[model samples]
Target: MSYRHTLTAFILAAVITPGAHAQSFDPGSMKTPDGQPDISGTFTFRTLTPFQRPQALADKVALDTEEAAQFEASERIRLNRDLFDPESG
Candidate 1:
C-alpha cells in the first residue's frame, strides 16, 4: 500500500477502536465514600503462608516462634530465584 493510504487507515482505526473495547459497569455498586470505584477486592494478596498445613502441623492453628523461624528459612531458600538452576527455570 502507498504510505498515504496506510497513514489514513491507521488514523481511522485509532479513532474508531476505542468504542469497540468499551465496558459497562454499575454506577452505584462498589463505590467508596469518596465515589471512586472500590478496587479493594481486586488484589489477591501474595504471601509465603502455606496453602495447606503440613501433616505434622495439621493440629496447629498457628506456628510457635521457633517453628515459624525454621519455616521462613526454608521458604526463603525455596523462593529464591537466584538459587534456582538456570536450566530448571
Candidate 2:
C-alpha cells in the first residue's frame, strides 16, 4: 500500500526471478505424427524481373536464348554495382 512496501516487493521480485535470455534451436523438438520432418508452408525465390514486360520493352515480343542471357547478365551487374562499392552519403 505504501511506497516503501511497494519498493520492497519490487526489489524482492527482481532478486528472486532469473531473466530468460534465449533458447537454442533443437531439431528434435520439431516433429509430426507421421515423422516426415514436418515440412509445411510455401517457399518463394524472389527475382529482380517483373511479371509483366515494361512499357519500354512492349514492342519487343521475345528475346533469343543468347540475347536473354546477355540481358540477365547486364541486369545482374547493374543491380549488384552498388553492393560491390557503396557510395559515401
Candidate 3:
C-alpha cells in the first residue's frame, strides 16, 4: 500500500524466491584442445550375483552356510575334473 511497505515486500520476495544458475552446452559443439571430439575413459563393471539363477534354485534368496559349502564343493569338483582324469591320448 505505502512506498516503504512495497519496498519491504519486494525485498522479501527477492530474498525468499527460489533461484538457480546452471549452464547448458551442445554436445556436438564441444571439442578437445587437439580439435578432436571430447570422450570419456573406459570403465569395467562387475556384480556379485548372476542376473538370473537356475530355475531349480529360484525360491532361494541367499545361500545358507551348508548350501554355500555344497555349491563350492561342486564348483571345485567341476574345475578339477580334467586334472584328475588321466585317460587322455
Q: Name the candidate that leads on lDDT.
A: 1
**Number of clashes found in candidate 3:** 0
In terms of TM-score, the best-performing candidate is: 1
lDDT per residue (tens digit) for residues 4-67 in model 1? 9999999999987886656555677789988898878655436778777868788888888999
Off by over 4 Å in 3: 1-52, 85-89
Looking at candidate 1, what is the lDDT of residue 15?
Answer: 84
Residue 24 lDDT in candidate 2: 54
| Candidate order by decreasing lDDT | 1, 2, 3
Cand. 1 Cα-lDDT: 0.78
When 2 and 3 are scored with TM-score, the better candidate is 2
- List TM-score per model, in order: 0.37, 0.35, 0.34
Candidate 3 displacement at residue 33 in angstroms? 20
Alpha carbon RMSD to native, model 3? 12.2
Candidate 2 deviant stretches above 4 angstroms: 1-45, 84-89
Q: Per-residue lDDT of 1-89 in model 3, one digit per residue for the tens?
A: 69999999999878766442234556766678777997666754343343568676789888899988787666555656776544741
User: Deviation in angstroms for 13 in model 1?
Assistant: 46
Candidate 2 per-residue lDDT over residues 1-89, each given as its tens digit:
69999999999888666542235567876777767687677855367575778676688888889978877876676767776544531
> How much is 9 displaced in model 3, in angstroms?
47
